[model samples]
Target: MVKKSVRNKAISSVLGTVIVLAITIALGGLLYAYSQGMFSNLTQNTNINVQAKIIVNPSTNDSYLQLTLVNNGNLGINITKVTIDSNGISIPINVYLPPGQQYSNTFPLTSKMIAGETYTVTVYGNSNNKPVVETMNVLASTV
Candidate 1:
């Protein structure tokens, strides 16, 4: 009878340890999954795409600077200004673009554009109160 009681106590002790270990592993896995989702939601970013070109009118030979802005992020961006390197001029404008949307407009250039010349155009904007700037180099072409 003494030997049988000892054997039963040993079995119960082993079963209790197994149950605690299993519970610990399951809790650890659940915590890892929850933290992954929480951190991903906190780390979001804004992305803006910029494109520019010098468009020359075929009939009148007048050149104009065309700008195309695209918001490819999950946020909205407000365009505040644009600067052209060829003339060293900055134009102030107010334009708002939502996510997955595009804005395109042409501005008249005071100076004539020479074909095959490259120009640098810079765009300034804000998204979520953060300043954003995008610059692109484009060749002058007639259209």
Candidate 2:
């Protein structure tokens, strides 16, 4: 009777261990699946990037400041406003561009561009109620 009892106890101990291990594995798998589903529902927001260039068109005799803006990102942009700043004065312009597109505008200058002066251009856009801003600096031509 003593040997039979010992054998039963050993069998029960092994069976308990196997059940615990199986439960642990099942729980782990469920947790992994739940986490994957949760992550799959998450998404990344759209990003916008723009490149700008300023040049003096010789054909215009430096009377106009030409600006070239390019959208260089994967997302589309709905431009709302454009502004040029010189000596603290803000000039608003109406311009629009889409993704992977370019926009060029020439603004007439009342005075010649001074050497070493800095000019700022700001672009404001929107995407699904999100505001986007892009700024570029242009240095006055010394020539």
Candidate 3:
């Protein structure tokens, strides 16, 4: 009588197929996430134009800043931050505006504002975590 020994493998053909398919699906998912980030970056890098005006309330003896943002790009934008600075004074604001939409905001003055002074206003926009910046010069009322 002759004795024969058989070896058993851990992974069969079907199990190997399943493992390959799982790895392929995981790699595909990772690639999709990476491409999404890249596309979002491309979309956010856009040209943004914002118009600003500074008005002083003579009746109230106070001054305020006004801004009109026009979204002329093809993509929608979300306003993230608005800042005004003059003579080392900084004012920060939060605003949201959409594409092809017009929005305005009035920022009150905390200190005495002088006439004929120049103020810089910066607006920041985001589209899919991408940033867009627009800066404008606002001259105070010389009245």
Best by TM-score: 1
Q: Local distance difference test, per candidate? A: 0.84, 0.62, 0.72
Steric clash pairs (candidate 2): none
Q: Write the per-residue lDDT of candidate 2 for residues 57-128, one digit (tens) a residue.
A: 445546446666666654566777655566443446555556567777666665555545677867787766
Candidate 1, 65-104: lDDT as tens digits: 8888888877889999998787786878899999889999
Question: Considering summed lDDT, which 10 consecutive residues are worst modelled in model 1?
Answer: 1-10
Better of 1 and 2 by TM-score: 1
Candidate 2 lDDT for residue 69: 65
User: TM-scores across all candidates?
Assistant: 0.68, 0.50, 0.58
Full-model lDDT, candidate 3: 0.72
Clashing residue pairs in candidate 3 are: none
After superposing candidate 2, which stretches have Cα over 4 Å from the reference?
A: 1-63, 110-112
Across 14-128, the per-residue lDDT of candidate 3 in tens digits comes to: 9999999999999999889878774554454355678777777666768777777877765677787777765454555556556567777777767666667788878877876
Model 1 lDDT, residue 41, Cα: 36
Q: For residue 24, give model 2's deviation from the true position in Å.
A: 21
The window of 10 residues in a row where model 2 has the poorest summed lDDT is 39-48
